[model samples]
Target chain A: MAKYLLLKHYRGAPDPVNSTPMDQWTPDEVTTHIQYMNEFADRLKETGEFVDGQALAPEGEWVRYDGPGSPPVTDGPFPETKDLIAGWMVIDVENRQRAVELAGELSAAPGAGGRPIHEWLELRPFLSQAPETAE
Target chain B: MDERLLRSLIPDTLRILIRRGADFASAEDAVQEALLLALHRWPKDPPRDAKGWLISTAWHRFLDAARSEQARRRREELVLAEPPPGPASGKDDSLQLYLLCAHPVLTQSSAVALTLRAVGGLTTAQIAEAYMVPESTMAQRISRAKRKLAEAHFTEPGDLSTVLRVLYLIFNEGYSGEVDLVAEAIRLARELTKLSDHPEVHGLLALMLLTEARRPARTAEDGRLISLAEQDRSLWSTTRIAEGVNILQRALAQDSLGEFQAQAAIAALHADAQAPEETDWEQILQWYDELVSQTESPIAKLNRAVALGHAHDPASGLAALAQLDASLPRHTAASAYLHELNGDFATASRLYSLAAQKASNLPERHHLIRQAARLSGTDANGPWPGSGE
Candidate 1:
């Protein structure tokens, strides 16, 4: 069976509209959102289909290796970028069709104020040693 | 008289012609033409000596094609000079084809196709089917590869590693169209082993066999992906596993380890386990370490992280994963798994969603989305009814 990595990102949603800002969202709202996502992950784990997953901080540096005797260079946090990645997940499954099914569900991750984010999640397969019977 | 038997004899015949100085491309085309002729003629009147019939017919066809392409004067001169008498039959000439196919001039893909056709005796259609390319395209590829090799003066033989790589690519293609590439690869590997004494060749064959043993239990009834932990051990093929293990043991005894040997060692460890928990993660990790040293591939390191996760703490796996660049193949998936093991559900879920979207093939994409849905407590129903899609 092939495995895939599912990347989660926000799309088409207005940036935090509340006066309180995301950091000041009521503790209950924060708790509820965390619980909701947690419940989802726990359910997957129960099925034994869950492999692993993680959230990413938006801020990061891009490093480039030039060559021998060349110093590595770094750049980051471009102000012009729009699509911000929130996090990612990985699962081993039989094929691509199954990957889409799972992506549809993740696209509905609950966002700020208990609204479905309908986020854009990208799915990528892990290319491992082809299964023994593949050829 | 069966098609299978006829196909089985193709490699040997092609091998004989090649040894006598035919270039890989010409030798393959000649052999293929001979097989086509066999398919037409054998049913009506099976040849008394099938190998001899193919070698003689293919040899002449090869000469005819060579003669036709030359200037008339040169053709006449060559014909007047007379060709070498065909070697006595039953010489297992397939090895020569292997060497020619592995000619240094041919790119990996062309070499694989030529090898499969000439040494495996597989039809061009079969080779094309295996790669999911149009038959015409494959034909062009094979022809171009052959022409390139001919121009490069690629008459010298290649090492067993080249042949093994070709077989590995063939096996990796999985089943496509009407071709059973896995079985074909195994058959070719077996044939190659008979012709060479390389331990790595034996290691590669062993690795392929061991992995193939679990094909029956690799997927669900509905064609959904099944994880190793979830696979039914009972369904694994004991006979193939035994054969693989035996070969692996003999290869290991040589102690001149190669990548295939390391991979086979890992597979052997997997086979030894009766259940998922019983799997020897430490041994697998060791093999992966050896593999990384030998191959220095990011994928090997990624695999090693997974082994570490099972052998030690998930956190340790995550730590190892963190050291790898995200662009490395499977880095995201490996990170997601490591996070999931660390109880970072939100991160895991998000990664799953990303993986599902980025998936290149249908099965892997579907599997990723399923993971996302299960984590989020949402419906996991996908567009496809069954996984074979």
Candidate 2:
């Protein structure tokens, strides 16, 4: 099986079909959205497809080594222009088609009027160490 | 006791418990407990009869567990089977374990996990580490697999082919990392040979051995894939190749040819070659033909087209390729190679780039990118010749 990552973006991606900001959404709608995501992951777990998943706190810093002896440098929690990862789910699936299908289902999570989000998700494959076959 | 030898006793011990009417799940739990005790206790003072010790301990464990859980009172009725066990029951026990582990009700992944767990006798954590998955996820998977098996009456023996297919799947999916999963697969397949005399079993083992022999030269130190033709011939393992060829010859002599035997035959031919130029593509092509005839597999047909290209001419290969769907996983790559062979480097370059873009794995993508660069008359490692930005 191949592993795939479904990445949710706080910024940087092009506008999705339903482009309503999540903060503008009603509390009930946000609850519905979270419930849908949890159920989706639970279903994948039952199907033996889920690997690991977690939503990240939006507040984060970019750090780098200034030099061997200097304190590590830190940037803002998140600037408007900086690309931020909102959350991610990793799944192990039979093929790319299955990964795509699961990603599409996840993208259907409820949004601002409790309607489908249709949010653009960045689906990336995990680079595998193992090669299954020669021919 | 050697852990491998101790593990070898598990299938029979588990089988005896099962035959005495323990349900699959609890029996497995009991066997696992017994194994843990053995691992903890055996090294200091080894048992005189390892299998007997395990069976007795697991049986008592199952009884204790059954007694403690009074709500499921029906288990009390499952006292034991009346018939006396026979001498040759050992082989049948392991074979039955193989069949049950590869039950048709389970998906391929579940089958692999169950086979490694019940037969290979690996811990869930060990399996998780081996496959590079989280332990909780693997625990859930194994439980789900067991639940699926319970729904299907959990682990009744089936046909040998199903087990052979599972072993083949494991062999293909393996690579060395924390646990050398390929070696584990090879070890399990070797163990399976004693349990069944099926030619396909030997064929599958031979196929794995032959393929594994080339692994040393298959990839560069920097993790770049080296194509078979580009590989250093001196690096291939001759001992494994010899063993594989010997096994294939014996299987072929049985005169019951299957798809795996055909595949093994092709692998044997490739192993026989001392150099890229010495490969007998014609014979390889014929074996692919045999494989195709046996299974009507599209992959086999695609491989045959490649062999056709090398054996006859690129034109013949292209003609054959035209009959197959272009959407097949390696179709574009195969087409690119044939195009390059037929002196259409421009088209070959374009197809190679496309194939690289579509590659599912990193090594293959890198290899395809290199091919694209090669045909476009450029070096892969440096900047483009005429463009400086």
lDDT winner: 2
Scoring model 1 with DockQ, what do you get? 0.03
Local accuracy of candidate 1 as per-residue lDDT tens digits, B24-54: 5666789899998988899899899988998
Q: Per-residue lDDT of A1-135 in model 2, one digit per residue for the tens?
A: 999998887567676676654433443554456567768988999999999886554457889989888999998767778876766899999999999999999888877577786777899999988667845
For model 1, the superposed segments whose C-alpha errors exceed 4 Å read A1-135, B19-24, B43-45, B70-73, B76-93, B155-157, B378-389
lDDT per residue (tens digit) for residues B1-389 in model 2: 68778777777778888777787777888988898899889999899988889899999999899888767564546444223444647677768778888888888888888888788877677778877788899878888888888788644557688888888877776674555667778888898887777899899889989999999999877556788888998999999999999998898899999998899899889888988889999999989889999999898899999999999999999999999999788999999999999998877877776776456664575567567656664322221111000
lDDT of 2: 0.79
**Model 2 Cα shift for residue A43 (angstroms):** 35
For residues A10-108, could you state the per-residue lDDT of candidate 1 as single tens digits?
Answer: 332343222122222233443444455666677778866688776554446778998899899888753435565556788877688978887776655
Model 2 pairs whose backbones collide: none
Q: How far does residue B238 in candidate 2 sit from its true spot (Å)?
A: 1.2
